[model samples]
Target: MATTPHAFETLKLTGLGRSFGGHAALAGLDLTIRAGEFIALLGPSGCGKSTALNCLAGLLPLTHGTITMDEKRIDTLSPEQRGFGMVFQNYALFPHMSVERNIAFGLQMRKVSRSETKRRVTEAIALVKLEAHAKKLPGQLSGGQQQRVAIARAIVLEPSLVLMDEPLSNLDAKLRLDMRTEIRRLHQSLGLTTIYVTHDQEEALSMADRLVVLREGRVQQVGTPEELHTAPVNWHVADFMGYRNLLDVTVTESGAEGVLVSNEDLHIRGTAVGGVTPGGAARLAIRPEDLRIASSEDTGDGLIVAEVAVVEYHGREFSVGATAKSGTTLYVRSELAPQPGDKVRLRVDPARALVFAADLDAAGEPVAQTALAGEAAT
Candidate 1:
């Protein structure tokens, strides 16, 4: 459906950093949140997603850097002065106030006239589809309903930006999924410029227009879900994006199609985002789903002999754990659920397997072949 256009310009966070007594929580985060864009700040715990959100909400002081909205500096503004709406993980609605009152509290605090406050509160409730529960207190509502109310309260102010910190994290799995759709729909309808901080990969991938993946207070990769999933720039990002099989391989040959890499026990040719030259050390990244497992009798050009370690039934397919002849453990998802200790052949599409520089700055280096392998038995 067509929706109203966004009113604001871009919001820029430049060299954003927050330090506490010589220890840095967020270090030099630079992002440009375009108007009407939904950006998810995604990372594991302590990756500075929340810290960045807090800084944007004016809840935390920036140790360094500036925040600009429409080319106007606003990092020094207080939370109220910034006039941004915030939704917390725990629904921070007033226990004593009804839904309408909770949504109208901001307007009341701003000393808005009663008629305008009522009109805005009505619009917000309708936007969240909480019109039926307008008179109910937060405690009387379900988790999802309460969260809708929280969202209504935030949007009632008609702020230029909206900040959400794991807003659906408190709900059950199904509720979280439902809210993901709801939030995305509301975002488009309102033409909101939102900054969502979420550690859940699925949530960020499904909702955000773009994702900023963070690790150790640094931006690892910023791209669309498909870009991050299919082409991780580094081993750490590959790992984070669920590239479970990471093998150390030395480049024995390089060509236009891809590079040929070899380990002590196996040699394979694969592609890399960056050029991998001969006589260079690199790590090969392969997703479990991209791996093919079959009987040794199956004819394949690049099959590697392996022994199945375990198999796990994942509803649609089986996740098989196996060790290559080179002793590199890997996980393979297949329809044929191979039993434990079964001798098999492992194969991968040359294009599906990605290679990264060995010295690439991974979040944490895997110590063994099984370091990132999945353990499951079908």
Candidate 2:
């Protein structure tokens, strides 16, 4: 990592889009990245996160948009000319080259002086704590060590911005956690502006200053982790953020605080989002952890009485799968264990629940949503 803070201003993307034979891979991506800020592009597969990253890295040409760095246009520049360092998912290391040589390759190609190249390579190795493996080839290093070399190779250039595409996806769970800390430490120590792309919501939440959620080649929402976790802009984003129970219902009332929605036998009041209106069809989202087992003595207006269909002990608590009288499946987490076919009541804090307009299909019809109760456990 470099010792000095980055000196660049904001990097702006206006209507950034990419198309492949008329199919839009990325569309209308408008974002401003400040110097030394860590931003994460998060979504599931085929959600255009990698496409957005490639466009920023200058590896992909824009169909219609502009990329500006410090008020200067950079969209027309080549990858090397833009001078942005990138770390790929597969580690992209030279198998025959030693770790030290791999880190020095970029400097050598740039025709930097031999003394400067050696000095920077030494510093980069020390920055990633790969001194012990400097002389080893890529083939001899573990997956984590290879990833460190890849990171070192990128940071050795001391570029103003760094882009990482799922760099830790290949590592084991423990290594992934360790590298998350390492990456955050490096970003802070070097004051490097970073754009990280990951499908893992936990990884993005833990490491990014802000997160951009994408769907079908468009940006859905951009906010801090807390903002996105507590108040997603729509149902698609809420589903991605771990709200597993989605039920379709009709809105009975709407107000400043939230809205009241109900089906045949169940009624719920939750925070209204995505322009939900009274008398309109809507979807309700609830996290299993937020849905708790109601005690026998507990009486509430928002109680959801159901019959438990399955229960699994998850170390700290039990995950109960229940079906309401209306045939809607519900998943809830509780400290108490309940057997199958047992009658129970579930309660959710209205503040923690979310409600959005019903999703539509290609024909513009409201699509029926189903809740897979098993997903709450994982």
Pairs in clash, predicted candidate 1 = 311-377, 311-378
Question: Over the stretch 38-103, how does candidate 2's per-residue lDDT look in tens digits?
Answer: 999998788899999999898999998999988999999999998989999999999989999999
Question: Model 1 — TM-score against the truth?
Answer: 0.88
Q: lDDT values of the candidates?
A: 0.85, 0.90
Candidate 1 ranges with C-alpha deviation above 4 Å: 1-5, 275-279, 295-297, 323-329, 360-378
For candidate 1, write residues 351-374 as lDDT tens digits.
Answer: 988988765336533344343332
Indicate the worst ten consecutive residues by lDDT in candidate 2: 369-378
Residue 313, model 1: Cα distance from true site in angstroms: 3.4
Candidate number with greatest lDDT: 2
lDDT of 1: 0.85
lDDT computed for candidate 2: 0.90
Number of backbone-clashing residue pairs for each candidate, in the order shown: 2, 0
